[model samples]
Target: MDRFARIDTLINNARIFISRPSNRDTEGDVTAVLGVNIAGHITQLAAAHDRGGR
Candidate 1:
């Protein structure tokens, strides 16, 4: 912010996929993916919006 003065654009490209098969995936693994792939992006977007990013 100090260097750029203001945020103009936000490009979200973060994701998480379970490497193993669904049958082999544990509850913790599924939870972690959901937390990062969904909640994490939402949190980031909220932050960017607060900073005036488009």
Candidate 2:
């Protein structure tokens, strides 16, 4: 935001998912999915909030 002078919008479409149960791993799958879907969104939202974003 500082570099751009203003931030109008923030769009995050990044995600992770396993279609088949057989392809899923115990630790790694849960970690990746939660990291991307939950933790990642929280981090980005925090950043936007700090920058006075809407």
Candidate 3:
């Protein structure tokens, strides 16, 4: 989303490729992958807000 791009320097595969397939999703896929990905992205927004973003 534009929000993430604005707050984060970039979105890297490293963060997306973390949690293994098993731990990543209930179907041993990407259900949790998306969840984890969103969390990482949110961290950036929160940081920016805490730092006082316009």
- Give the winner by lDDT: 2 or 3: 2
lDDT by residue for model 1 (1-54), tens: 568765566666767887777999888998888877887666576576676784
Candidate 1 weakest ten by summed lDDT: 5-14
Summed backbone clashes in each candidate are: 0, 0, 0
lDDT of 3 by residue, 1-54 (tens): 455544445454434564445543555346555767766776666566757782
Per-model TM against the reference: 0.46, 0.47, 0.41
| Model 2: how far residue 52 lies from native, Å | 9.4
Per-residue accuracy of model 2 over 1-54 as CA lDDT, tens digit each: 457765465566788878878455788888888888886676576577667774
Candidate 2 segments whose C-alpha is farther than 4 A from its true place: 1-9, 22-24, 43-54
Evaluate all candidate structures by whole-model CA lDDT and list the values in order: 0.74, 0.72, 0.57
Off by over 4 Å in 3: 1-28
- 54, model 1: CA deviation in Å? 13
Which sequence of candidate numbers ranks them by TM-score, best first?
A: 2, 1, 3
